[model samples]
Target: MNVTEVISPTVKCRVHLHVHLDGAVRPSTVWELSRQKKLLLPGNGSLKDLEEALQIRSPRDLAHYLQKFRWITPAIAGDLAAIERIAYEFVEDEARRAVLYTEVRFSPHLLVGPGGQVTARQVTEAVMRGMARGERQFGVTARLLLCCIRGMTENYDDTLDMCTEFRGQVVGIDISGDEASALDVDGSVNAGLLRAEVRTFQEAARRGIHRTVHSGEAGPASMVKLAIDEMKAERIGHGYHVLEDEELYRRCVSTGVHFECCPSSSFLTGAVPLTETRHPMQRFCQDGASFSANVDDPAITRTGLEDEYALLRRMGFNEANIATMNFNAAKACFLPEEEKQDLLQKLRQAYGVPGCD
Candidate 1:
């Protein structure tokens, strides 16, 4: 599982679709921002310290696990410069891991500090500016997914308005937060009805905006089904629980619902159990379900894209399988066709396929 051994120069395959930008910031960047802002961090000036604080070993509920992100939110505040620096560094880090294209997502709601300081419009512009900088500096084609955190005060109407205002700059909209809280949308139902949220998703779809949902992470398999059936999610984030329903698994495979699988986070959160051997990723792959590996929260999970791939490789995933996963991800991305075609060409070249050119 050594990153160096798997990332040899000969292996030039690229990771094209990862969706969490702020979540992927380096610990050093977090520390630097914390220090500059005079914010207190509970670490010994190491990535391990950050990981220990963020990673929940024995959590009573999902909210306790998600509360960890609140600790890092302050570091990301204070205006465009800080946001831009972290965005640039995030792309640079991805480039080092051989990622040629990426789609990073975040909710601008929390970026604004106390007293409604930073406007939502400003937050969008700052992030897009940083994305442009990353593209120019690193040759990594980037896109943004403006997300709405579930359980936030803003209901569907407010979220729709935000998405409409930043429509062009944002490629899509996603609902992300604690899956456990999402399950609480209704008192008796175990799975939340995304039907209400589907109004925005459908509207985005009509406008040709790609849609994806953070479903089945810690909830029942029915939640994943609702995301696909109700929300028309082209992709599912952390869809580990989908295997619970045979019908849903069949539909997911048959219909090509790309699952953005993150093993490290799933393992740490007790979603797939601790051991990598018993992880649902293997089962999902075996069942012919399309999926891509991702470092859901590189900063918190203390991992990188390379580490995720290396772990899968050790667990008996071949290079070709990894390449297929990458191809699936590229196809599932919310980028322009020309950009996606370019990435497909790169993938073919990396794998030494003759007809790819």
Candidate 2:
């Protein structure tokens, strides 16, 4: 049986909260773009070669996993047309997997390649146009989120500014990148950079921009606490390590901070071990914490939203549990109050879950 046969029997509508726009570029698209731009590809430069190269079959550190971007990113980055095409394609891909709503994220500055003529605003505009067209064509309600890479202190303000400028289309702001590199050997946090990141999130909060931080994926539990307490993150990306601290985990459960869990990506990135008896999300589910399963990087993990649900099933989460997680995702989405309510109602009708609304 395939992924759809396994996942479609139980989980119906889905709300995906954590996925990177750049990381989801279609391998075929990457192949075509690389050929068009005369860019080099691994092996024979065929589509199969590109596909084989993008996937991370061997588990490695976070930094090693990120290096995969160097292959596909150059194809989409600095090219406004490529960015727009991929954005439109992203919606269609998600819609096929029964994702009714999704919030895709990327850093605009990164899209503006080295010495490229395109401005950050233009990059955002292209993505918005593509996604807008996609929404009409594919029937998936899509939103945007700007990302600030950790250690790139210079781009934080631009990310927040874009979130404020594109409030309705761009739903929120996020921070993602190497967590270990941000700390010293003694575990001393990089105070200056941390303060700058905090200031950016504080401004985002004051401007009413929704905030989510990539924390505690490969870092310690303290990063999750800092993301919640100092950065005012409304949701956490990955966040498996939050379970390391019992007090913090209990507090998170009480407060209902959403966790965007990516099972395949977490394993491939070495954030979680293959031989573990229990997964952190199992604890989150048992403790009544709010969390959702997602595909962090389809390009790398070679999985989809349905694949994530299947993984959750294998991890011992039942159909009801998966439905509740989808409901939790709908609740935690960054859409406006009225739109969010509409989404919840749609989910209620789709899942036919009593008292879910």
Candidate 3:
């Protein structure tokens, strides 16, 4: 499962394991959803202004980029049909780009409608409905990864309860949201916050729910190790910062914990420069560190899986290096062994490599 062993990507690699469901919605859909929901666009008072905002230069950092989510979160959360459309449209978008598989993440608590009208189960089911329709219509295999935001403690229990309720429906649990934020959504920020929060993740571990963590992107590499030794994360979301600590990076490579690198999003974050010879993606690959390409927030960054590949290509990654990332992504999925192997077999076939099955 070493990342450096991936086959040459002679064929186009379209398999993605990391994407945010709410952030993958179509731009046109965003406009329509905003209009229907009467959600005021952030920093965009007029249609002209909104257009400019969409094309606005990416914010300075991860925290800064997240500010745009205020408008996006409201538009998709309050309405059932809107959520469904968001899912369906994302799959359709995936199909158009020839992406065969993807794991989409979103927090159900954030999807609560006006007045806390929707239960976590209802919101999850709504997303499932759209996922089902999208899979059927577009021939893409997708699964949901329910995200437990770090700062939102009160709803974490309810969210985890609902996730357990829909156990067979979603693939796994993910610890997500803004780790850089000083306070949780509930206005609590004791130094012991993350220590206490690991309790919820431990519950997920006891229930045998697979876990992945959003760390090492904006945060330090130490956060990545905390997620592994403490949170039981099997893979990492945007863990490019692991390069900062050679020892931790080596540990991850040895243990086979995959790092999902979203170059376009990282470029926006100002953390990892996407240079041809200097990007973290290249560095990780060169060092044989396990990592793969992804679109962290497609709508927020306005990039897709193909564009990410293109970025790597522009950065001097050959076809084989690109294929190595595809192989790493497939092998790193939070799926059952048989399913993971099958997907890897498919990736090998697409890349014209030797079969594993």
lDDT for model 2: 0.89
Give all TM-scores, in the order shown: 0.88, 0.96, 0.89
TM accuracy, model 2: 0.96
Error of 2 at 204 (Å): 0.6
Pick the lDDT winner.
2
In candidate 1, list every pair of residues with a backbone clash. none
Relative to the true structure, how large is the alpha-carbon lDDT of every model? 0.74, 0.89, 0.77
Best by TM-score: 2
Sort order, TM-score high to low: 2, 3, 1
Instruction: For residue 264, give model 3's deviation from the true position in Å.
Output: 0.6
lDDT (C-alpha) at residue 40 in model 1 = 76
> How big is the positional error of residue 53 in model 2, measured in Å on the Cα after superposition?
0.5
Winner on TM-score (2 vs 3): 2
- Alpha-carbon RMSD of each model: 3.5, 2.4, 6.0
Q: Given candidate 1, what's the lDDT at residue 169? A: 58
Off by over 4 Å in 3: 1-13, 42-49, 56-59, 182-191, 273-277
lDDT of model 2 at residue 351?
81
Write one digit per residue (lDDT tens) for candidate 3, span 261-306.
Answer: 8888888876675343488788888878778889878877777677
